[model samples]
Target chain A: MDIIVSKDLKKKFKLKHGQRVNNNGVISNEIVVLDGFDLKIKKGEFLVLVGPSGSGKSVFLDIVGGLSTPTSGVVYLDDKIVEAPSAKTGYVFQQYALFPWRTALSNIEFGLESRGVPPEERVKTARELLALFGLSDFEDRFPYQLSGGMQQRVAIARALATKPEVLLMDEPFAALDAQTREILQNELIRIWEGTDTTVIFVTHSIDEAVFLADRVAVVTARPGKIKDIIEIDLPRPRDGDIRSRCEFATNRHKVWDALKAEVNKAQQDWKLAPAFAS
Target chain B: MRLLTVLPKSRVAQREKIISLALGGSVILLFLIGWEILFQSKIVNPLFISAPSRVVLAGITIIKDGTLLHHLGISAREFALGYGAAVVVGFPIGIILGWFKLARATFGPFIAAMQATPRIALMPLFIIWFGLGMTSKIIIVLLSAIFPLIVNLQVAMGTIDADLVQVARSYGATRWQIFRTIALPTSVPFLITGLRLAAGRGLLGVIVAEVFGGAEGIGYMIQYAGSTFQTDKVFAGVLVVAVTGITLDVVLDRLGRHFGKWRSEAAVH
Candidate 1:
């Protein structure tokens, strides 16, 4: 069953660039980020979106999570139109986005707090999530006290505290070292296996896409649309050794082949007329 | 074998504290001795800069007579009320200005102008309006202290981490929740700084107002003694004010360090 769906999703941003253009006072320029972008994420499916820098992978994820609205077209979360950010969807940013003032436990309790869960129940749920993330020892530590990998783990725990039906992540481990990234990727799969949560993860790394995703969706350059969807038939219970497998390399190659032209076009477009907002 | 034995960290810290205290005490003792020697040697006129001994005598006399305590009580009350009012009033105004663009646009320039204007310059007007009394002095203190608190808080509100707000929003938090959870906790360091600034300004305001025209307060005592050429009494009063200011500041600094412990912890990153 399709848990989350978007029909002809389009996002346009009106950004003011440089100075006046010929004194006509036409200070604003509109760039279409996503146009005719369509995708159907199945229930409990692990999907990874890969694209160039300026492509609307992040934007589409934002729209699906209700963090943003499409310029045109519709998005449905469980057949109901998504108009605003709802507790039903959880979003994890690349920068971790853990509240610096809040401890690991309190940060995890944030969504439960928003949902008006009672204090005892909130603490209980947060503690359980913290334990599940293997951060029970660091529950009282603030975000700054935790290492990068640990902070990301807390962020994931925070997002999952509400038991959201879908999880949307935008290059969540992009800032970590390669080894940490791979460890987190495996950790993420293990966690996903325990829940019936649908995840739509966006990343620039083809290796990440091939490793974690059931299907890799390659989005095109600006005015983004899905260029190709490559299926990763790698078996479940995949571990660190999965990255060394021949099937992983082949799937990674396929995603790269589909994404290479879009990346080149995006780089050239950036060089030619760089819109500032993206 | 004994040479290799090292002191524990706490023992080292204790020794450092004792050394610092002794050094600080000696400097004060030396300063007092130098002033007394200057007076005794007739290098400086006692009529102008009274010796520490005479100042202590004058301080004791006022204390025994209950005059110093009386004036101190009045001044302390004025300061407490005024500073308290400023915090109670200014903080919300600042948050409002920061949270609402419309409020800021309407009053921001006027607030800036008032802040730039020397608070002491408005003393005569306050005296004229409220009369030469405790009310006028308190008003002066409130006005002087409020600007720093308001301005700091307003700037703090603007400086909230956008990413944190985004995280809260993703959780479907209400605007109030965002402010309560994100903006308030993050603004704590700024608030402490504002309080410290406000304390100094408030003290200045009370002293200046009393000195201008008042029958009570430490400022009035100093003004009266100076006018009467009682240099020792004047010095005694001035000493009281200095001690009060320093004590208030130290208390605030300790409070800031306590509440803002996370700030220094974050800095380690």
Candidate 2:
């Protein structure tokens, strides 16, 4: 069963400025954050998108999540066109954007609230989810009181509380320290294994893509287009030992090679501009 | 153990306290000395400016007569009516304008124009419409106070961080939920500030309207004293108005500070 399909997804943004700008204002040059991006994910597949910083990976995930409308394209989830944000698609932002005003439990309960889940049921489910994330003790604390890693866990809990068919994450662990990122990565794998939800994780870390993804999609810079898809034939419940294995190194290198050209191009592009040169 | 560790640091804090007290004391002493010299020289008519001593005596006399209490009560009642009306009308209108684009487009410019037009100049018209009763005074106060309420709320709503709104929408919040949970709470600090400003303006409006034509209130007393050339009484009335305004401002400021603390803690996150 197919969970997500993107066909020739294209997006362009027009940069406009100035007063009484009667003109359509020059295209300034279209920024194609996504161009002819195509991908398909099987139901329950853990798909990771890995590329350089400006590779438009986040934009692609946003398109699939329906947080943003594509300039021109179609995204189908569970055979329905993903036109706008809905309970079927859950997005966990990179910044762990938990509502500052809410306690951890309340933040997790937010998605349930949105879905019209009754208060008693929501509280029970949120508490259960927080416990699953080892955050049961911290439920009463505000987001500010929790560390960065804990906040991200709360964010993940909030996303999963809605029980979506697919989870879209954009650099969810990029802000965390290496140790915390590793631990959360394992937790994510564990959670994904436990549920039927299809996961589309976007990240810049090669180890993360290798460890968590069933299939890794590498993307090119700027007008991001999928360069290649590498399927990890590794066994389930991947842990730290996988990193030391030759298979892991080979897959990592394969991804690195697929991404190296785009990375170089992006760096060259940055160098030609004064902003990065300084 | 903690108390022992905090003692040396506490001395530094105490030194700051002592310096502040000394500065305050010296300033008050200098002011009293200057007032005493002015009274002795009789540079200005003692009756007109009123020596500080005579002003104190007059305050005592008014208190004894019970007229001072009556005048204060009347003024307070008028201020409460005016300010309360302004808040009641202004808050909801602000929320509507802030929430609905059409409301903003339709009424925003008109509100701005009303705010720009000085309310003092409208006192005569209000008197004509409502007459020289408390109704006219309240209307003037409402006019003076409502503008800041609307303007602050509109600005607060307009400037809410877009990310927070996006987060709310992503959660599938209904329009009302978004308004109640996010927009309303976020706009509160600005609303409180506007309310405090409106309180002062409302007081000003009450006094101005009363001075123009009113049977009671502190402003009426000031007018009576001015006409009779009983300068001490005029000074006494002015003092009462000044003290009232300052006290109201201080109270509102404390209230604003209390509410503002929540936003600051949110910012720390």
Candidate 3:
């Protein structure tokens, strides 16, 4: 059964007249971020959405995670309409949004605390996840005390604390250095393959989408919807060495080919409004 | 020299601290000596500015007679009550104003107007209404201190990282839960800053109110001494006020450091 489904999802941001839209002075009464966006994810499937900068991939992910509501249409999770955030879906943001004041252990336990999980069980779960992420020793350390990679690990652990059925990640490794990003990507895959969670990850990098996804969904430019869904015919238990394989190159090329026009269209939109091009 | 050379690495830190203390003390010592010499040689009129020796003598006399302690107790009580009231009152209001746009829009102009009005000038009105007692003085301090706390906490709440709140929301945290966990903890550093500003301003408020009308407090003592041309007594009172302000500030600074250890550590990272 499909764990997540969005039926004709549309989101439009209304702006007041003469309101500062972007750095560019392009004024519009409404900016449509998503229009008739639809996707269906099978249970435990690894789906990655690749798109250009302003293609509303993150916006759609937000809608799926229940962090946002679409202007029109409905999102169904487990055949139930999703209207608000719950323990059903876990969200990993682009920024490591770990609370600065909380230590690694407490941060991982945040979702559990919200769910009113008993303190002893919460501690056990957090420690187990911490150990899983190689962060057991740093559980007492605050976010600022941890490296960016470690912080991201804690953020993921925090999101997974409630053991949600679906994990929605929005460019979770975009801020990391290249080496850290690659290492984390491998670690993410390793950790995720062990779970039965349906993953919908969004990114701009075709390499990332091809590597992490079972199926890569390429989204169109503004008023974004699914352009193409490319199947990654790679084997399971994928690791860092997958990137060196010819199959990896072929799938990467296919995803990029599907995305190239949208990327150009998005860039043209930016060029027309030069302020946002930056 | 040999003992110093043989000192351990940990003792070197102790040595550095001692050296710094000595360096700081030397400047005050030189200033005191210069002041004493200037007065003794009659370069400056002793009546205009009393020497450190005379100020000490006057301080000793006041202490022996118990007046200094009495005034200090009264002033301390006023400061404590007023500052405490400001925090109790302003903090929640500030959070509300920051959290809700409607509340901020409604109260923002009034807060701005109150803050802009010179609160010192209202002392006479307070005295007339509440009389020449601790009530008037306490109100003055509260008036001066509350605004900064309100303004700062509001700013802290207003400028909270939207991403953090979103993360909390995505975890199924309720609005109140988000406020309790994310909003309040994030505002700690700002609250401390606001408290510090309030402390300085509250001290000024209390002193000025006492100077204008009170029968007790260091401000009153200083005013009475000045009226009688007792320069030594006036200097001693001024010294006490200055020391109290410094001591309050230092205590608040230590509190800030304790609560905001996470923030300071962020800068290190």
The whole-model lDDT of each prediction reads 0.88, 0.81, 0.88
Sorted by lDDT, highest first, which candidate order results? 3, 1, 2
Candidate 1 lDDT by residue in tens digits, A111-185: 899889999999999999888878888888777668899999999988998998999999999999999999999
Interface RMSD after interface superposition, each candidate: 6.4, 5.4, 7.2
> In the order shown, what is each candidate's alpha-carbon RMSD?
4.2, 4.9, 4.6
**What is the C-alpha lDDT profile of model 1 across B93-199, one tens digit per residue?**
99899889999999999999999899888888988899988999999899999998999999999999888888888888889999999989977887888998999
Task: List model 2 lDDT by residue over B1-269, tens digit each.
Answer: 12111124478879999999999999988987788678779897765666667777878888899988998898888889888888889998988898789999998898888888988898888888989888888888889898889888888888776655666677667878778777877787788789878988988888888899988989998888789887778778888998888988788777776655434343522
Steric clash count of candidate 2: 0
Task: Report how far off residue A157 is in candidate 1 (Å).
Answer: 0.2
Interface RMSD against the true structure, candidate 3: 7.2
Q: State the weakest 10-residue window (summed lDDT) of model 1 chain B.
A: B1-10
Single-chain TM-score of chain A, each candidate? 0.94, 0.92, 0.94
Worst 10 residues of 1 chain A by lDDT: A19-28
Cα TM-score per model: 0.93, 0.85, 0.92
DockQ (model 2, Cα): 0.23
- True-vs-predicted CA distance for residue B52, candidate 2, Å: 4.3
lDDT of 3 by residue, B244-263 (tens): 88998899888988887666
- Candidates 1 and 2 compared: the better one by lDDT is 1
Identify the leading candidate in terms of TM-score. 1
